[model samples]
Target: MSNEYLYIKVDKNSMAKNKVVYLEDIAKLYSTDTDKINILKKQVVLTIKDNKPIKCVFSILKIIEIIHSIYPDVQVINLGESDFIIQYQPKKERQILKYLKIVMVSLIIFFGSAFAIMTFNEDASVEEVFKKIYELIMGSEKEGGTILEISYSIGIPIGIIVFYNHFSKVKLSNDPTPLKVQMRVYEEELDKTLIANASREDKIIDVD
Candidate 1:
């Protein structure tokens, strides 16, 4: 085994049969450049203890804790695993920053969209248009909102909320939301880019 790679078998059957499973076998599946296998040989054990079989399950946090104790630079990736691959992750601390960045981006999108709509309404003189329509309907100068203005004011937001499917949280029509579809496309592209970059970097390291 190499320090660059560690294999762990997440035995669902073993977990079901035996309430407690030692990490010894998982630890033996990898060795460092120094040919040491005892590094994590007796380090950790996963135990459901007295928990019911149906409710008891493997904990990712415990597995990660065991792995991190042995290999700080590596991360476990489940590969539809009888055995799982451990890959190099450059900066573990950066995971927190990644989540923070997502939250910031979400806030920006929410507020920025609201601001953009307001700016567009102002630029297009939407209020003036509504006022004119109100006067035409009432057959006099517009003092307050007419029936058209009231109906439109209520209808526009409702239309937007329904069209986006956010009000009911279910699609009324067959079509998926443009935003959700675009997000999926972006996620796929990002995954491809990351994989390509990782492969390129590995090749470069191999050449060196």
Candidate 2:
């Protein structure tokens, strides 16, 4: 998946006074980074950082407040951030269920046809008997009296086992869908915050 980078342009003078804010501090304020980002200069030039669309946009507003608080005549413009949303392909549960159904049905058809061939041809070879039975159940031929007897006696039970076995293994062991997406976003946000806090502390230490 593609990630987005949010850019906020502060005044040159403000930036000259400070440097750049940590990316982590911006992420902590915003939940996601899905917005237009950019940087510009008019009165003073500060710094730009990454943040989510909704939160970062709002954060910029607060930033304007902070700028105006100090430099009342400062010119601030929202250069806007860049947004990148990657399209993802995810498998649906229905596809898995449909595949299983086809397999189970195919097995039942095979077993039914075998039973029919065995009933009709008393002298038929084992393979031939199975083939004829397969054709009959597939609606290719009419069922004979012998086929009816074989089906009730054995075919039904075999069908049940085949279906049960196929269905039992339908679920996959490693499915990366819901949880993975959420976790990725969470981890990214956390990492950003940690980096920002560390940078801020470094600046304080330098000042001291």
Candidate 3:
């Protein structure tokens, strides 16, 4: 295996489901020799013993060193990111806590959005504008629960649904929802930040 080549492709970020993360969990490995590929896949990349959220960045050079320890002259090819972040989040089986969290977030989002909408409407004087339009249209004073109010109430939810492009597991299109897009952007940004900090702080695992 002196002249053999091993190819590795690693993502910028990965999530470890188990406490022990293997090479195959964070990266894709390939080699002409099936035996080498099989063994390489099981190589321990990292171990998580702490029962808390752990974020660490790893350099590809460390992986090369691991392979070199096994096959000294094997050429290692990296086709992915030079540095990648592995985040380990330990799972807890607290059903009540999970439901409580869900309820709290639901309440916060519900009330927060309602407050924002109300403030916007007040600032814009939506009711006054609606009443003016109603007077001009019907030649009379507008009462509560008029067609304008009913349509406004009905249209708000529909508009929100269309704008968000998602509702209760229902997808309006094949494109990703706005929330998912924002979350993805946030994850990528966070990974970059962690990787940069690791490099600057000299905490990233890399070979000499």
lDDT of each: 0.55, 0.42, 0.91
Give lDDT tens digits, candidate 2, residues 126-193.
44565577676775753454555566559666665554443344633345445456887886675455
lDDT of 3 by residue, 99-200 (tens): 999999999999999999999999999999999999999999987769988899899999989988999989899898788899999988988998999999
lDDT of prediction 3: 0.91
lDDT of each residue in 123-150, candidate 1, tens digit only: 9998898888767776778776577667
User: Residue 111 CA error for candidate 1 (Å)?
Assistant: 4.1
Model 3 regions more than 4 Å off:
1-3
Rank the models by TM-score, top first.
Answer: 3, 1, 2
**Per-model TM against the reference:** 0.43, 0.18, 0.93
Note the residue pairs that clash in candidate 3. none
The number of the candidate with the highest lDDT is 3
Question: Best candidate, TM-score-wise?
Answer: 3
Superposition-based RMSD of candidate 1 using all C-alpha atoms, in angstroms:
13.9
What's the CA RMSD for each of the models?
Answer: 13.9, 18.7, 1.8
